[model samples]
Target: MEKERRWTEKYRHLLQAFYFAFTNGYARGYTNGMIFTGKSKYLCVPGLNCYSCPGAIGACPIGSLQAILGSNTYRISLYVSGMLALFGVFFGRLVCGFLCPFGLVQDLLYKIPFPIKKKNLPAHNQLKYLRYVILAVFVILLTSLIHDVTGTGIPWFCEWICPSGTLLAGVPLMILNPEFREAIGFQFFWKMGILLVIMLGSVAYYRPFCKYLCPLGAIYGVFNPVSTYRLVIDKEKCVNCGSCQKACLMDIRTNQTPNSPDCIRCLKCVSACPTGAIDSSWNIARSKFESRLLSEEENSPNPEVTKTTLLAILTIIAGLATMVSTFKYNLDGVLVYHFSGLTSGRGVLAYMLVTLFKGIVSFFMIITGYKLFINRNDENAVHRFREQTRMILKFVIIIVIAGIASLFADLSLLSVMFNAILICPFPIIGLPLLASAASSTDKLVQGKGSAVLWWIVFVLLAVVTSYIAYISTVIILAG
Candidate 1:
């Protein structure tokens, strides 16, 4: 029995290693620090393996899902979604236990000698719900709802959250690609902070991410109750000993619930059952007596943070992106690259504000271009192109009108409402002026003190820039 346990453990690890190697088999790409943009890239791997990983031959399902959700067309990733549903219906968290490379990483991390290991985290039950929140917010809501100028949503999970990509894909690419390394900034460090916390947490707690923060795991776990393969307990042979619970690393009370959603099908509970009551099964034909013995009441399970922290983190990320845009825009240089600082003291403060707004636009443009490019051949590229074109036209019309008005003011409109003052404040001032014109009050803008303050500042700066331009033009004419 002990040998069986050992052999099973070894087999799971071996399978994990082989699967990881197979998913990331383009060793030469790793050597050259390149991504494999081959036919196999169309396939989605059933793990959290990164598509951007140098050696990865297949795409990560979650990333693929995000790309589709965040695209201009906002189409569902049928391929990725189908793959996930298929995997979930069949395997559930078995992938977490035996297939996910990140899962294996956490398993290996736990094996390293540690002074004090915890059986369960504090508030483990409630905390487990966090993965669901992440799935809903980062993976779905942010990716689908919040869009940029290009009508492309950002993959908020990959951009600001995923530690797996940071550790597995980001680090290796950073080591290989000079340009990628150069682009690394606060975003990279923010990801590293998340990664460090997961690594340290895993050392003390088993599979902390799989238990709590993994959006993929949360998705798979939902199918566990209905999955084709499942863990079973024979009630006739069962003596209600706590041995199974003792051996189960997931803190699952298997005696009451043999097929708990959290169960990774590690088989520890099966191996530890003194009466040999626990077993893995596919609901094959069995005698009525045996079926009754396996059956128990279905009633079971357990269930159930930082709004300010999230706000601060998001603000920091936004500020960093804005900062990067103001001076040297690395985002495909939609326009001028270098510029004076926000406090350059030339009454050109609107330029700073414009750059901030530009950065915001550039983020969407950059992400949209990336998503469209990456998933172009992978999907209906034609639909995406059309969607983007329509969105661009709608925005361009506004910018054109703003441009004409700004030309009169000798101002560079960057704000959207400029769809008044002009090239620079076109979008920012767009809604307010339009709304004010219609209703005599921009309720949304007027309701917020901060919004009102920023609007005042923008107008004052624009007037100053117009005066500067007029003076310069007059001097040039006189000369």
Candidate 2:
């Protein structure tokens, strides 16, 4: 355990966590040994992880992008793309640096003891835009072409290019499940081979896939110039030591301009700065607040107000529980059975209510997303709302469309209600999980009992659902 605390070891732990998420979360089959349904069921990992991985806790943004792009609606992937652009604007490649597990893997690989050469690699930067091209071609153009020809929508990337999918979901599950092993074909081998090559190269180059091909990175990079948390160089104070340039993994020379779309906000340059001139900050308020707190000797111990400590604790518990539950179902042989209930068409009302609730949730999602777009200089709520709601009419169409789709799906009352409650936690899970590795709580570790209560609620719900399925199956068998 003591050996694990080394920085390299700690970073490797992050890689292990990343590996665990991909393999155990997305790739592994359940205890029931079901096949992955190819639905965009898992959440996007914000980096390069593919959506088809059964073990994923949340949806893959790229998969969502493709689905929305090639949806039955045939509308452009405005919401998914908008979300990506919004994240980019707020954090830029900061998502890749701090949030992406795949990037963490690459970082771990780069730490190996060997002679390393650093170069500008702007040629590679140009290729970063290729993800946008892939989004357009595979997601939109090819999806449209294939569907038009065959009346079936296919995710070409999941079938072909996504190495994260193979690394995290494919190999582990195939090894564990005999059924999965039998199902593996030439295509699976092809994907594994491609992923192997990428893995080998990743040991040498730093995130070749990210630099040359991740659409999510391209989308986020758009937000780099304007993101609140960014690298700030005092042009007046830069001594041209060029150390900052050498320190950057993204090959961005911070002394020249830290505003490059390629900048990952890894803080290597900030830490390496000799003049103490570089200052990396999240927001004006946070930076100012931290500066004041650091200046004061007493505030150093417990910096910042304890305003959202409860919220943070609740969030952590919810996220951790959800991750564990999702992983269990995907990996540990959980069975999903369809049940018929006494309530039927009346279920439509339940679905309607759920749909309404989902719409409201999307409203908050948009509000939170757009709030990031507002200039930090602006303080008035009026301006914030105005800037956020400029495209309200378009989003009205989106909400109505989503509502209409919900209304039409053939689902049960209990299922619909369950879906609504399930949907609510997603945004809550998303914002915080993407922000930090662990929970954002006080870390003083109080009120753990309340968090346990939340877990109990979830487990009870799962158990009840399982019991219903088992009973229904037994009755059918007896008959």
Candidate 3:
């Protein structure tokens, strides 16, 4: 019996590790410019896998939840909600124990060879409720509420808080994309700080994020009592031993409540049960019977909706201000033009960096303006026009800055690289934005020749830019 229990524990760990590897097998550590953009990305995985990971083939449920909520549509995505509900109802927190990449990370972190001591600190139990608070405020309320006021919603939790995302996706992307590294600001540092704290906490506590701050975990946990898959306690076979509770990483009092909300369905309790009193099952009737035997309600504090509203409003204002400042700074100062005699190697590198920066900035600006235009109601047409004008002014300022910098140095290589990067991404990103903007303008103001004229001018500019880039590249290479 002891040997069988040991094997069960070992096999569970191996199974979890297998699932982690299987889910992230696309790039498989070959972090070049490789990302799986296949059809599988539309599907949400049952675990917290970062979509930005080079190897990830599926979207993260929490990230998707936040994104749909924060969309301008302001409608709940039945597809995403249905997926989450299905996963929760069927498997409960088994997803956390046997699937989540971050859950596996925490488990491995806890196993490091150190004098690891588990302490039941004061307020530890209360901390378990924090994930629910995060779910309510960041994942659901903030995303749905912010779009009404800002014309654009922020994925507040994913953008500002997800440590798993920072570690799994942000770090790898920054390492791979030099342009993303160059664009890093205070937010990157803030996220790294959060990731660091979580890492350190994971070393000491078992599944700290799952226990205290995973919104997905909180979501799955709600179905613990009635989920089709469940952990059951056989009172007839029980010896009043506390071994199962001791084995539980989630700090679940399994002897008293087998299907506790905090349980990860890890089966550690099942393995540790001395008299084989604990078992797992897939019967709805059994789950219902077990739930009746042990009934406990988890009490969580209600979120302050008023405070959340005020914070969301302030965040949008602050974000817009920051965006303007960052855009101006990137355009004016990100590229440094050397007046010294440039070597071929140095010139090429410098040209590439500047071009990359310009491409990224242009893509963002066009997308932002496009979203504002399309999402604006008739009453907000003037506001959208003003915003678009400001963006255009910013673009003009960037062009002027580049022109001034060109005068100080040999711009042959720089101009070629800049135009190449600009023209390539502009069509990919700008075409959609332009089409959307034109469509929106036509609907709002009929007989608007201004939109048509602007479209013609943009086409002309693109053609001219592409021609210049092609000619310059040919000339430089030939020389």
Candidate 2 wrong stretches, greater than 4 Å: 1-45, 114-129, 148-150, 290-479
Candidate 1 lDDT, tens digit per residue, 284-372? 33444555534521221210012112222222333233334333432223233224332223223333344444555435434444444
Candidate 1: lDDT of 329?
31
TM-score of each: 0.58, 0.54, 0.57
- Is candidate 2 or 3 superior in lDDT? 3
What's model 3's lDDT at 137? 96
Summed backbone clashes in each candidate are: 24, 21, 0
Please provide the root mean square deviation of candidate 3 (C-alpha atoms, Å): 22.8
Question: What overall lDDT goes with each candidate model?
Answer: 0.68, 0.57, 0.68
RMSD of 1: 24.2
Off by over 4 Å in 1: 1-6, 282-479
Candidate 3 global TM-score:
0.57
Minimal lDDT window, size 10, model 1: 300-309
Name the TM-score of candidate 1.
0.58
As for candidate 3, its clashing pairs are none
Model 2, 351-376: lDDT tens digits are 44444544544554444434433422
